[model samples]
Each structure stands twice: as structure tokens, then as C-alpha cells.
Target: MDVKTKMRPQILLFGDSITEQSFRSGGWGAALADTYSRKADVIVRGYGGYNTRWALFLLHHIFAMDNRSAPVATTIFFGANDAALPGRNSERQNVPVEEYRDNLKKIVQHLQAISPTMIIALITPPPIDEKGRMEFARSLYGENTMKLPERTNEAAGVYAKQCIELAKDMGINSIDLWSKMQETDGWQKTFLSDGLHLTPEGNAVVHKEVVRVFSEAGLSAEDMPYDFPHHSIIDGKNPEKAFRVQCS
Candidate 1:
């Protein structure tokens, strides 16, 4: 890249399916892009159905340390799959809570190595609703649905606790989606679409929380400068005059 070429600072959203699906209509990632418009680029590095153990493989690839234009901040949101109940169809995704915690630490460490000043935020897996999971399974498999839910709120809580503790130990930002969503009545349906994934309302919650944390950390969009001159400041008769100063 040419040194004179302007590149917008970036914000990376990385994690599992939830993060992957965050750019859907009314999704949190889209909301973030809108919020950071002209200030920074929001990049999504989500992998559907991925867990922390699997995520490690792509860390260096997705965030090459040598890249001169590194993201200003990143959000690591995994664990929903890692919390899968053992002995279930989704058991393959289950990871020991301790291992999950360590993987998160490793991810954070790598990002810091890339850019020590880059902000890293960890988001806990959202709560699981066994009934919702079962219903969703039944819709696909009818009576053939698994006899038991592949995930449970209790198991998710365990992982969420580990995530929260890890964030505190690492001195980074953390979002307790598990607890935050449950604070609302009927969150199982209101915030979650299929027990695990987020509904639009749920995405709104994430967007709100992320903005709050970022704002407190001195990353509020209001404080950020636009990458180029605002339209209002541009001279209609001499557009080059406005851009030339910035280009120089």
C-alpha cells in the first residue's frame, strides 16, 4: 500500500456463527457499521459453527501481525458452540470450560502482540433455552429430534462465567450476553431466534452494549474524525481545494 493512500482505521468483529450472522438485516454488525460510518471500517471475520479451539487456526491468518493497517479494535465472541452438551449431536463442538478460557487468552495475547494498543473485547455466549432448541430441532427432524437438547442454559452459564473471569484476569473488556439477555423477561424468545442465535432485538442489545463500552474506552464515534472532509465543508465551485489540503 502507498504511504500517501488513506485507509480508514478498522474494527474487527471475530467469532462463531453469531458473529457470522451479525450482518443480516437488522444485525448488530450492520448497526456498528452505520455507527462508525466515515470514521472507521467494520470488518467481519466470523466463521459459522466455529469454536475457540477451531478459531485458533485462523487467528494469525486473519490478523497478520505485519499488516501496517491493523484494526483499532476487535470483538471476540465465541463459546456458544463450545458450551454444547457432551453426548449430544453437537457434542463435537463441546470444549472443556478451562480450555475455552485458555484459548481466549491466547487469542487476546496474539492480538496484543499484533497491536498492543488495539482494544479487545470479549463477549460471552448467549444463554441457551432447551425448549427452544428442542422445538427448532423438532421442526427439522420431527419425532426424530434428539431426545435431549444439545445445549443448556446451565452449561452455557458455566462457559460464560469462565469468559467473564478470563476477561477480568486479562484486563480487557467483556460483555456478559448470557446474563444481560436473561435480565429481560421472556428473553428466550425476545432476544434469541432459535435458542442460540440472536433475534433482531438481541442484536440491538449487543449493539447498545458494544457502543457503551467503546464510548467509555474513548472510542466514541463522536470523538473520531472523519476520513475525509465533510460534504458541508467542501467548496462546490472548487471541490479539489478541499480534498487537496487533506491529500497533501
Candidate 2:
């Protein structure tokens, strides 16, 4: 393929609703795309309300080993739905804590098989605001809703810690959103939208963490080449020359 037309390496964001919403206005995924604009393609594959168990079956379809466009890096983010409380949509999304950790290991192993060099990052589920989430849940399920919320900050923290531990065991990077977001007072009001989802400010937090992790993994933006010369730097008289990727 012509160098100019060559496919760029990808940074895949794979997860559930949080990942799905990562490209929303002022979202972390959008920020990453802009930051890596000419360097790498930031692709998102998010399945709303999906747990790790459901994700396992679909992983092969998303990252076929035969595909030439292998991702340079992949973020396997889950656990939010997996942390769902028993008897509250448990049949649909909940997974035991031990199983949750094991599923994450399986995911990493699968990615390693696809490409041993592919950088993997695991993101712990962000903390949930039980009060706010319960309110939201009540609104969705009516006043007759159950006593406990579908997800809770405490439960999410447990899963988050496991994710961090899993990352250490697998020798991959991990982002502890569950702990970082709650470090400050009134974090729930500032960072979360409806107890479960992220607010614009929350997205910013994730964006910063993503950059931090990517940098630590030696994938700094400064080190990556722009896909093409900046428009301002292009010669107006011969723009095509600027557009062409020079053969080394």
C-alpha cells in the first residue's frame, strides 16, 4: 500500500456503556481521538449493559487474528455491569467477583494470543453513587423498586481493586477510576451524572488517566508521526507534495 494510504495503527477502547458513551460530546474517547488525531486511529467498541461474560463471546469477532490492522494498544474496560447486585437485574448482567477477575484474565490472554506486543490496559469500574443511582433506578423502575440499588460504590470498589490486582498479575497497565474519582469530597456531585454514568467532568478525569497510562506505556503523542503534514505547514503551491508520505 502507498505510505500515504496505509492504514494507521489503532488504539481500541472496548467495554460497556461507559465505553459506548466515551465518544459523546466532551467525552474521554473524543479527547483521545483529538490528541492522537494524526498518530493513531482511536476506535471504540462498546456494548451497552454488557458484562464480561457476554463480552467474551464477541471478542473474537471484533479482533480477528487474520486482520492485518492489528491494534497497537487495547483497553479492556468492564465490571460496572458485572458488579450489578444480586436479584436486581442479576440474571442479565451480574457476575461473581471471582468470576469477574477470571474473565478479565481470559480477555487479556485472548488479546495476547492475537498479538503478544499489543499493549493492554484494564480500567476498573468507576464508583457508583448509591443514593443517586437508587433515585435513578426508582425513576426507571418506579417507586416499587427494590431496597438496594442495582450497583453500589462499595461493590464497585471491590471489583476495581480486583482489576488492579489482575493488571499487576498479568503485567499490564490498569486505571483505578473507582478510587481516583472518590478521592475528593463531593465527588459524586461533580463527577457522576446519575450515579452510574460519568459527567463531562468525569470524562475529563478518564481522559487524563488515559493519557497518563499511555505515556507510561511509552506511547506518547510526541513520539508518534502525524498522518500527514499539518495543513498550515503544507505548501499552497504544491499541496499534493505535502500530502504524499515520503518514502524512507
Count of residue pairs whose backbone atoms collide, per candidate: 0, 0
Candidate No. with top lDDT: 1
Q: lDDT tens digits, residues 1-248, model 1?
A: 65422457889999999999999999999999999998888999999999999999999999998888778899999999999988998999999999999999999999999998898999999999889999999989898869988999999999999999999998999999999999999999999998889999999999999998888877999999888899998989999998987666
- lDDT, residue 184, model 2: 73
**On a 0 to 1 TM-score scale, where does candidate 2 land against the true structure?**
0.93
Best by TM-score: 1
Candidate 1 weakest ten by summed lDDT:
1-10
Model 1 local distance difference test score: 0.92
TM-score against native, each model: 0.96, 0.93
lDDT at position 74, candidate 2 = 90
Off by over 4 Å in 2: 2-7, 240-248
Instruction: Please give, for residues 139-237, the per-residue lDDT of candidate 2 as tens digits.
Output: 888988767677878999999999999999989999999999999788897999899899999999999999889988988888888766777878899
Worst 10 residues of 2 by lDDT: 1-10
Model 1 steric clash pairs: none
